[model samples]
Structure formats: C-alpha cells, structure tokens
Target chain A: MKKFVQVEDVGMRFDTKKGPFVALRDVDLAIEKGEFIALIGHSGCGKSTLLNLIAGLTVPTDGVLICDGREIAGPGPEREVVFQNHSLLPWLTCFENVYLAVERVFGAKEGKPKLKLRTQEALALVGLTHAEQKYPHEISGGMKQRVGIARALSMQPKVLLMDEPFGALDALTRARLQDELMKICDATGATVVMVTHDVDEAVLLSDRIVMMTNGPAATIGEILKVELPRPRNRLELAHDPRYIDYRAAVLSFLYEKQAHHEKQAA
Target chain B: MSAITFEKALEAGAAAAVAEPAVVAVARSEPAASAASTASVASSAVPVARDGGAPSPKPESRAGEWLRAAARATLPPAIGLAVMIGIWYLATLSAGGSLPGPVQTWEAAVKLFADPFYSNGPNDQGIGWNVLSSLQRVGIGFGIAALIGIPLGFLLGRFATLSSMVNPIISLLRPVSPLAWLPIGLLVFKKADPAATWTIFICSIWPMIMNTAQGVTRVPSDYMNVARVLNLSEWKIFTKILFPAVLPYMLTGIRLSIGTAWLVIVAAEMLTGGVGIGFWVWDEWNNLKVEHIIIAIFVIGIVGLLLEQMLIAIAKRFSYE
Candidate 1:
C-alpha cells in the first residue's frame, strides 16, 4: 500500500507537577492515500493526542510525522482537523466560517468569487446550504458538526483528521453523520484519520481500525482491516458475521486485553 | 385586527423593516387585492412563526401582548422610584425640610435645563458647558488608555512571563483610588485639566488592561487550535480569530474603563478646580444653592446612565450568541 501519511516511532510525553506523563510511546503507523483509518481506544489512551500529532497541532516528544512525502513541521491547511466540540467560530455565519478556511487555503491563488464559490459548494456538500447565513449557536449539534466538516473539507487538505467528530452527538445524529462522512470520503477520495470509540462506527466507516493499548505509554496494540465492500449498509451489517466478528475483536481487545483502568483514574 | 397583524409583523423582524415600505408600496402601486394575497404568506414565520409556516392568527393579540410586556418591564422601576420619593418627602417633612423634596428637585431641574448652554464668563457657564468640559477630559484620558492598554493586554495575555511580571504591579496599583493619583497628576502636568485627565487615565487603564488580558488568556483553546491547523499567519490569527473572539471581553474592558473614567473625572475635577460638573457642584454648594447641587447630581446620574446604556447596546449588538 502507498503511504500518504507516515508516523515513525512517534511518542508523546507531557510534563505535570507530579512527574513526566507518558501518553503515547513506540506508536508506528502508515496510512495509505484515500484510506479511511480509525484510531480507536478508550478515553485517555492518547487517541486524540495521536490525532493532534498527525494534524501537527502538537509536536511528538519523539519521532517524525510526514505528510505527502513532506516532514510535518507544524500545522498547515494541508492537514485539516474536525474537532470534537465542532469548534466553529460562534461569531461568524456558517458560510463565513467555512469561507475563512477556504480563504486561508485557496485565497492566495484563487480570486474572491472562486473562494466564495468554494465556500458555498462545501456548505452544499454537507447539506447545510439553507443554514449558510445562520450563526453556529442557531444551528443544532448535528448541524454544527456538519459545518465543522464543511470547514475542514473546504480547505481541501491532503489528510482530514477528525478527533471524535460525532462523539458529542446523539446516536441517531452520529449514525447519520457517519453515513454522510462515508459519502464525502468516497466522493473526495481524501485520506482521513478519525479517532472514535464507537466499534460499529470503526467497522462501518474505516478501511482499517488502529486500536491502541492502555496508557501510561500507549501503543498500537491491534490493526484490523475490515474487508467489507463499499457502500455497506448499517442494517445489513448488524447481521453480517464478519461485521460481528470485527466488533467482537475490538470489544474484547478494549475490555479484556487493555482494560479500562486509565479511564477510571482519569 | 390590522393593528395586531402589523405588530406581529414587527415582532417577526423578517419582513418587519421592508414590510412597512412594502405595505406602503403595495398600497400605492398595487391594488388592495394584491396586498391581501401577500399578507397571508407573511404571518407564518416565528409566531416562531415557530413550526407551521402558515398564516398567523390574531397578531392583534400579539400587539396587546407586546404592550403588556412593555408595561411588565417598566412597572417595577417606576414603582421603586415612587416609593423612594415618597420616603424622601416624608423624611424631609419629618426633619423640618432640611433636605429638598422630589417636587422641589423637579422644579429646580426644569429651571436649570431651560438654558443649559449659557456662558457668562470663564468660571461661570451653563450646566451643559460644565458637563461637556468634563466629558472632553474623560474622552482624552480614556482614549489614550485604550490606545495603549488593549494591545498591551493582548501581549500580557499571550506572553505568560510578561503577564506574571506585570500582574503584581497591576494588583498593587489598581486599588489606589483614582483621586489618590490626582496629586501625582498635578505634580507632573502642572495644569489642572491634564492633571484631572491623568487621574482618569490612571483609574481607567487598569480595567482595560486587566479585562483585555483576561479576555486574551481566556480565549478558548479550540480557536487557537483552529488557527494552528489553518497555519494562519500571525497577523491573520490576530485579525480574524483573536480579534473577533476577544472583542466582547475587550468591550467589557472598555465599558469598565469608561465607567471608572466617568466616576474619577468628577472627583478629579473637584480637586483640580476645573469647569466640570464636579467643580460646578462644589461651586453651587459654596454659593448655598443646594437645589442646584441636587440638580447637578440628577444630571450626572442621567448622563452616566445614558453612557452605560449606549455601551450595553453596543455589546449586545456585537455578541455572537
């Protein structure tokens, strides 16, 4: 498989008053181009820390992260993030929020009209054209997340990183957004690394699931490739033995192997 | 019924502004027949014109409701004022008229406002002139503070070391009364007006810096992450994200600073012996014109209230939520 994003011997350590806190260590992963990869782990397992590393929001204490054959120095529009809280700037209209991203990424080469067109197109893609003029607060949680997705995709980044994008939403909204995300991925052919705890979501959306061991020093314990064909339906997958087996493998790994001690402590 | 519809339309806020002209235009250019057709489509908006986008029922009732709301909002303040005045009148009567009653104050107010802009000499001027001179000083002092303080606030908020160094100094200086600086101002400027303004500056600068620094530091880490992920230039981050995000906090600082400036200007002017409301109040008291002094108090209060309300309205307008 062709690697689009390369993470080599990545480790992260945060300094606390007590001592040095090791979140991730010896974590190595290579994500292919146009691949849907899910980083799955229990809470406080540094799944988000790893995603932030990939997004270049945080520098790994050790090792290197490279995107599109270039060393990731710091965060750039090339690596876009859809944050957990749907971190849309509340002051801006949904259109303006996405437009800010579009302007940053393409504004240098593109004219004003083209930038606007890109913003409108991105909003339309997320089915939020009607809410383009509304502020983030006026919209529902699901809608805000959609706008968050729109803002990220509007950048047309090389790799899309989402840290628990739908984690805050209701189950129905989460399911609906998962489907929307799958469609967006299929259409854009963008490499995506999403951190999610939902086992079903991992199997449904990701080409491969990267589950981590429990922290002090968390590392990739298992990488399961879902061989399900494209356009998989959730209803049909419920009864699919392969899907059940994949879910069980992740569930057992999380509960039995890793345990939930870190979460309890946190 | 038409009254209700118009009021409901006003509450809707969608077609509210244009609708009046549209209503007038329809009345003029189109026939009454066409106007009736559009009216049905207009009322279905938030009534929330909430769910069914259908014609509204009895917006006439909404007008009554709006009026009732207005009354509900205003009644308490009016009643509270009345009660306070009644107590004042009773107290004045009981104490053998040492303090002026509400009616006496009202009469004095009317006479004082009759020619508020009159100018007799350098020391003798109308209440308006006094108020304006005071405002001019406050404006100069507060403007200078804002020019320096807001940017410094951003820096303090951004750099922890700088904030740490300055935070102790601010904590020490902030509690020193605005008038306490008046002597220092007098010693430096060697002029009454600049001295008064300096007092205002020293008093006002603290809030602007403190609040702005607080705003900058309190900026949601999420926004900073957005800036980082976008790889926005330092200028872009400041202009687009940081500026807008921190604006409410900055305005809050401005509001607080202006309030302190206004408050300090009065006392500073009294000490500095300038042509200001505070000086006028002292002048009136020395002349044994207590009623005029009372009138000055009301004028000062009303002006302060107006200034506060203006800032509040601006804050409300700019608020993201």
Candidate 2:
C-alpha cells in the first residue's frame, strides 16, 4: 500500500544575502497513519525546515511531498501545524482561538452550535475547559501551547505537524505535556510528526525517532523504532533497559557520530 | 494622639506580661518596676508592641491615607495654576493695563459664558457658538480625512509598490504648512468655510495615513501565518486579524490627526474670517477685547485637552495587552 504521507528525495535550499544556503538534501521519509514520529537533532539541523516543507508552510527546492495521494502545495486544514511559540492570537480567548480553526474547517457544512461544541470538545480534550474565556496572555505558557495543540487537533487534520511543541516549556511541564500528548495520540489515533531535541521526550512519545545529522545539509542519519510498550509510564521507563537502549542509540547518533564541532569550539 | 500612643503602650505591656509572667508582676507595679524588669521588657516588648499597634490604627490611618493621596494628586497642579495666575497678575501690573490680568480674564469668561449661545448675526455670535462652529469644522474635516486616509493607509501598507510610489509625495506635502493649502482650497471650493475645512483636512490626513500604515505593516507575522494556515478569506483575514490588530494604531493616528485638525482649525479660521473660535479671537483683538481673547486661549487649550483625553480613553478600551 502507498504511504500515508511521503517525503521522497526532498531537498530544501534557502536563498540568503550571502549565497544559497543548503538546509537539507536527499531527505526521504514515509509516515504511516496513526504513527507518532519524532524528528530529533541538534539546533540548526533543519529538522523544522523539513517539517515545514511537509506542512507546506514552505516549499522545497527539490522533490515532491504527497499526503494521502495528493501533492503538498501549501498549508491547508488537512495538515495542521502547531508552531513552537504556540502562536495563539493574543486578542482571542482560548476557546475563540480553537474555534477559529474549527470554523474554518467545518463552518461551511456545520452550524454555529456544532462549531461551538467542537471548540469546547477540543479544549476539553486538552483539559482547558475552565480557561475557555481567558485570553492567551492570561493563561500559562504550557496552557497556551495546549491551546495551540487543541487548535490543530480540532481541525481533525490527516497529519499533525509540530515543531518543538514542548521545547519552550519547563522540564516538569514538558514531561507532563509529553505524557498528556501520548494519551491524546492514543485516544485519537493521530498521525503526528513532531520535531524535538530532548532524547527522553523522543523515547517516551514517539513510535519512531528519526535522528538527523548536523547541517549545512542535514539528512536522516538513522531511524530507531521505539519498541517500548504503551501505555508507557515515565516512572517505570526510568529503569526500563529497552527504553534506555533506544534513547542511547539516538544519543550516540546525535553526539558521537553527528557531534556539532562549532558548538564544542564555542 | 498622646492618648492613642498611651493606649498602644498599655497593649504592649499586656502582651509582654503574657510572654513573661515576671513582667506581669512588673506591669502590676507599673512605675515601681526594677531595672532588670525594664531591660527584659525592652528586649521582649518591641515586636509584641508592633503587632499590638498595627491592627487598631489601620482603619483610621486608611481614611487618612486616602485623604493624603488625594492631596498628593491635586496639590501640584493647583500650585502650578496659582503660580501661573500670579505671574499673569504681575505681568498685567507691569504692562499698565494694556493686557488683562487673571481676574479680568475670569470675570470676562463668566460674563461671556452667561450668554454663550446667543447669535445676533453670523459674525456677531456668542463664544459658545464660535467654539462649536470651530469644532464642527474640525469634525467634518477630520471625518473626511479618516474616511479616505485610513483605507489608503491599509492599501499602502498591504502593497509595498503602492507605498513606494505614494510615500515620496506624502513626505513632500506633509511638511508644507496647512495655511499654505488655503489658497489652493480657496481656488477649488471658492468659499471660506469649506476652504478652512480643507486646510484642516490636509493637515490632519498625514498622521492618520502614516500611522495606520505603520500599524498595518507592524502586525505580527505569526498572526499572518495563522491567517494563511486557516485559509481565511480576505474578508475574514481583514476582520479577524488585520482590523483588530490595527485598531490601537488607528486610534493613535486619529488622536494625532484630531490634534492637528484642532490646531489647524484655529489658524485656518483666523485667516478665513468665519464663525469660529479663531475668528472670534481675531475679532476680539480687533475690538480691543483682550480679555475675551485670553478667555478664547483658555477655551482652546481646554477643548484640545478634552479631545486628546477622549481619544486616549477610546484607545485604552481597545488595547489587548
């Protein structure tokens, strides 16, 4: 069967003031339906660049991205992106923020009441029902990110694209959100492509951890399948040998093989 | 006050007695207490005294605090005004009655305001009519400017090419005095009233256009990204994203434009010779009613202040963060 989402021999080159910057080259991946995938790398590794290409936020210089038998031309409701900064419109309440996405996706067919129900349902899914009337500034950073997640999920996208969704959160908040996300994915059976730097986050949340080498032309260095059984618990996984092995493999690939030389010198 | 302090001292003594049973004996004895009792009392009584003193004085002090705060807010401006009036009085004394003093101006203001809206002829109207007419001209002129300038600003901000083409012309025209446009206004409309309004319009439009454009351009890219990802229609993008985002900037522009409009209306009406506060000022000067001119200055200042404050209040209402 054809892949649910395909990135076949994709390359991305950005035109900068100095010269053409090769961000990624010969990148290839296939994401199956209901799979939670994590793209892990050091900073400036173009993992986000690749995710943007898949979301069609930016176009690739070469190769075609197909989602469910259609070419990825530009951003649409079918593939929703949860930006790193949470990008909730500050003027809008949490409910209104999610409602905007819901209205756009389903407003033509659904009435206002149904749209309202969907918005409430999405916020409820993220356990932010109490904060429905609070604006983005009024809520905590983690809550804002959850609102962003709710907005993406509310659209019922074919693939959910996240660019370090929990990267800005505190360590404890990040862990709690990761577990919540795992539960969310398990409940919804969502096809997710998350870009993350934390090793344990990759091990805890993803079905497959796609390790990326350092740029100027970052590509997939290795892909490790997380064989840890779910419903995964972080406390239990702290001593789980297999979970440790998967994390170590990703760490070795990132640090030993693809160690950032410039960072060490700095 | 001494009674209150004595009461606080008694409360402290009671608290000290509770902390040390030996102090209770010393407290009962009062003035006959020993030096050892006094030393122990000094060490232990301080914190307990503070705790006992705090609660009782709070209710009375809070009322006093509010009065003090009110005085703090009002005193400086009052003093400044008194000093200004005194200077005016001194200046009038030195000028040997050619200029009006604060008292003369106040008396004239009271008399003028007593029959403010009376009108015998178009030129012979009350100060209220004059001020209202000036405000009307500013309103009409500013209204027209807003209707045109705001939309143009959005277009200019949205389209870089249009902005490039228009910005040089705005830069050239904006610096020219509003009165300089009066001849052009006179030439086109062939009437004094509309010409004065035209000057107000020309003077006010620049800030609105410039500020609104700046506001539009400065809208956060994240919001635009949200718009694009949602595939929002242009109308939806405008209403949901652009309009609300640009509102504060637009209000700021309106505030600035109204100030310019008010400023220009005075000068414009002074030249145009019509039923306005500026014309009234000139007419009063011609009739040697210097006190009336002084009143007009205060009126103009007060009206300008009120206009700015109104806009600021509206701007505050729309601000999100």
Candidate 3:
C-alpha cells in the first residue's frame, strides 16, 4: 500500500525556562490512503503533538512531513483536525459551525447559499440533520463531538485528524458516536489518524493501533494491525479471540513501557 | 485496584460524602444521573431530525410572554421611578415635611414640560433644554473618546509588549479623578464647547480602553488557535474573528463609559457653569430650590439608567450564540 502521509524522522521540541523539552525524537511513520489509524498514549506522551505536526499546525524541529505527496508547510483544508475539545464556536449553531468551514473552503462566488447545501449534507452525514440550528452549548457532549467531526468532514480533507474527539463524552454516547464515525469512514473513505487513550475505542475504530512510549522523549513502541473485519461491533469484537490477543498485546506494550520508566526513575 | 472496586470506591465516596437527606437535596436540585439517562433515551426516541431543530422558546402564557417582553424592553429607571414615587408618597405622609408627594412631583414634572421652550431670563433654561445640552456634550465627548480609544485599545491588546509599555500610563491616568481632569481640561481646551466635553471624554475613555484591552486579551484561546491554524490574513482575522470576539466587552465598556460620562458630565457642567443637568442642579442649589434639585437628580438617574439599558440590549443581541 502506498503511503498517503509520511512523517520522515520528525522531531519536535518546546523551549521552556527550565530547559529544552523534547516531545518527539527522531520519529518516523507512514499512513496509507483510506486507513483508519489510532495513536494511543498517556498525556505528555506527545500523541497530540505528533498529530499537530502531521496536520501542519506546528512544524517539526527536525526532518519533514509530507501529506498527499506534498511537503506539509501549514494548516490547510486538506488536513482537517477535529480537536479534543470539539473547538466548536459557542456562538454558532451545529450547522453554522460546519457551514463556516465549508464557506471558508468553498463558498459561492455569488455569495449565494453554497455553504447551506454542504453544511446540510455534512450534518446529515453525521446523523445531525435535525441539530443544524442548535448551538454547541445546546447540544450533548457526544453531539458536540459529532459536530466537530462534521465540521472537519465538511472541509473535504484528504486526512482527517481527531485528537481524542470523544474523550470528554460519556461512555454510552462515545460508543454510539464511535459506531457512527465508523459508518462515516466507510462511506467517505477519508483516511483518519485519531489520538485516543481508550484501548477499546482504538481497537473498535482503527485498522491499526500505534502505541507510544511515555515521554521524556517518546517514540512509537509498537504498531499492531487489527485484522478484525469491517463493520466491527465493539461488544461483539470484545468477545472475539483475535481482539483478546490484540488487546493483550497493546496493553502489555503499554505496561512494559510503564515498568521501564519506573525502573529508570528509581 | 480492580476496576469493579474502583467503581465501588467512587460510588461509596460520593454516597458517604453526603448524608441521606442532603443526598436527596443534591438529587432534587440537580437532575439525577438516571434522569439524564432517561432523557437521553427519550431524546434518541425522537427522530434525529429534531436534534438540530430551531431552539425551543421558554414556555409562557400569551399574557405572561407579553409582560416579559415589556419588562425586558422597559427602562429600569422608569420602573425605579414608579417604585420610588410609591415609597415617597408613604414617606412624605410619615415624615410630614412641608415637601410635596408623588402627585406634587408629577405636577412639577408636567409644569416643566408645559412651556416647551427657553425661559426669558439668563440661567433659567427649562429642564428639557438643559438635558438636551448635556446630551449633546456627552455625545461629542464620547464620540471623540471612542474614535481615539477603541483603535488604541485594539493595538495595545494585540501586542503584549505594547500593552505592557502603555499599561503604566493608563494606570496613572485612570486613577486620577475625573473632577481633577475637569480643571485641566478647562485650562487646556480653554473653551466651554470642547473642553467640557473633553473632561467627559477623559473620564469615560479609561473604562472603554481598559475593558477593550481586557476583551482583546481574553479572547478565547481556542478561537485564537483556530484563527492561527486557518492562516487567516491579519485583516480578515481582525474584522471577522477579533472584532466580533471582542464586541461584547466593547459594549460593556461603552456602558461603563456612559455611566462615567454622565457622572463626569454633571461635574464638568458645574465647573464650566454651562447649560446641562449639572448646571441646572447647581443653579437651583444657588437659589435654594430644593425641589428643583431633587427633580434634576431624578432626571439624571433616569437618563443614566436608560443609556445603560440600551447598551445592555445591544450587547445581549450580539453576545448570544
């Protein structure tokens, strides 16, 4: 499979008064077209930092990132990110939030209602056709995350980046939205790189889960291909033998990394 | 801990923190988790079509709706005036002063409005004329301040270094009394026309400037990041994102400015000895007309309240999502 996005030995660092802190060090990864990849790590493991670099919201301190065969320079409509907080403008209704991105990316020259059609389509795609006029504050946490997804999808991006989009939501809502998101991915075939801490959510949603080590400077510990068939049911997949091994593998990788860090600290 | 024990510990901790009836109070005051679960179920039963539907208005009877609308639109001072008069009538009977009651005040208010023109003698302008003059001065001063302050505020706010540099100067000027500025303004402008207005401007601009800067600085980090991520042009960011984001604060500042303007306007008028509510009050005090002074005080309060309410209404419209 051809690489759709490439992170070529990318390294990122932040300057603080204390000293220079490395978030990611000499990390390289490739994501293929139409692939759903989950990157999981604890906070400060630079999962979001890596996602931001790939999205071109921040430049890597060393090396390069390429998206859709082009060197990434800055954020554009092609690499849309649905942030962890949902980042929905509180003032805009669900439809309007989606419409805003659509208008910015593809508004009519005549200023006629081009945004309305795309926004309506995006909301419908997210199963939020009726929630078009409701503000972010008016919606449930899960629904707001859905609106964030709709807003990102409305941009018609090549790579959709989700930064723990369902982390704030309740368990049931998160599960339901996860199901809807899978349906969205299957329909659109848009490649996704989602950052999550939930082992179940990652297992259920991704074609592969990339687990990262804890950071003083973090790197990918392992990438496990999830061979679970598509239209995967979370509860059903939990019962499957293959999923059980996959969960154990990911958990052990995380646990092994934790033990290594604790030994280092001691 | 095992996941089940973790769950149990959390539940037990919550339960033990509150006594039984106190737990009931918490449950009643806040809808229970079960209620939210039920609501979610009920919500899902509604077709997804209703999720993004137009927001439901607060339920109210037709008459009640009309009354709420009226109350929202009504001037607070007018409502305050009615209440004050009701209290005043009771007070007058109890105090048994030679002073008149609500009926007498109404009669006085009516007589002042009856002539509808300037008085023949010097320093004897009608209340209406005096109010208009005061308004004119406030308008000029406030207009000048807004023109100067808002742009400067935007600049100061957008640049942290610049704000730090200018902040000390602002602090220095802000605390100095508006009354102190009145004498300086009188000396500097050396004319009643602009100088009196300048006093109002200096006093009023402090709040507008500070609040506008605060508003600009306090624009949500998420929105700023969104603006940055989009790589929006500076002008586009200012007009579309920055301006709208800071609008509520600007309006709030304007309301505060108006109140300051009114406060300073009267003082300015008293010092300048020109035609305004403040001048009217001072002139009445000189003549020892206590009733006229009371009337002027009421007028100032009513006008100030109306101005603030109008600004509040405008702010509310733009601030709500």
Give the number of the best model, judged by lDDT: 2
Better lDDT candidate (1, 3): 1
Ranking by TM-score: 2, 1, 3
Q: Tell me the tens digit of each residue's lDDT in model 2 across A1-266.
A: 34899999999999999999999999999999989899998888899999989888899999999999999999989999999999888888899999989999999999999999999999999999999999988989999999999999999998899999999999988988888888989999889999999899999998999988888888998999998888999999999999888888988888888875536535
- Identify the candidate with maximal TM-score: 2
Candidate 3 chain B least-lDDT 10 residues: B1-10
| Model 3 C-alpha lDDT per residue in residues B42-108, reported as the tens digit of each score | 3443443243332445423443454445444543433343334434544554567656655565566
Model 1 is docked with a DockQ of 0.61
Candidate 2: what is its chain A TM-score? Answer: 0.97
**Selected candidate, larger DockQ, 1 vs 3:** 1
TM agreement with the true structure for every prediction: 0.87, 0.88, 0.79
List, residue by residue over A1-266, the lDDT tens digit for candidate 3: 49999989988889999999998987889999999999997777899999999888889898999987899998888888888998887776887677767877786452647668888899988889988899888888888888889889988899999999999988889888999999999999999999999988888899999888888788887899999999898878878999999888888877775657846745
Question: Candidate 2: where is the Cα deviation over 4 Å?
Answer: A264-266, B1-58
Output the better candidate (1/2) by DockQ: 1
Residues B1-321 of candidate 2: C-alpha lDDT, one tens digit per residue? 222232233334444555665434344424322222334334444455455456765745554555456555644554444334444554565578999876577678789999999999888999989999999999999999999999999999999999999999999999999999999999999999999999999999999999999999999998898888888889988998999999999999999999999988989999999899999999999999999999999999999999999999999988996
Any idea what lDDT model 2 has?
Answer: 0.86
Tens digit of per-residue lDDT, candidate 1, span B1-321? 332333233223323324454334323322222233235333432254233323358655665565456555644554444334444544554567667766577677778889999999978899999999999998999999999999999999999999999999999998988888888888998999899998888888998998888999888999999888878789988988888888999999999998888887778877878699999998988887887888888788888888899999999988886
The residue-by-residue lDDT of candidate 1 on A88-156, one tens digit each, is 989889998999889988989999999999999999999999999999999999999999999999999
Show the colliding residue pairs in model 1.
B4-B59, B4-B60, B45-B48, B45-B49, B46-B49
Candidate 3 B-chain TM-score: 0.72
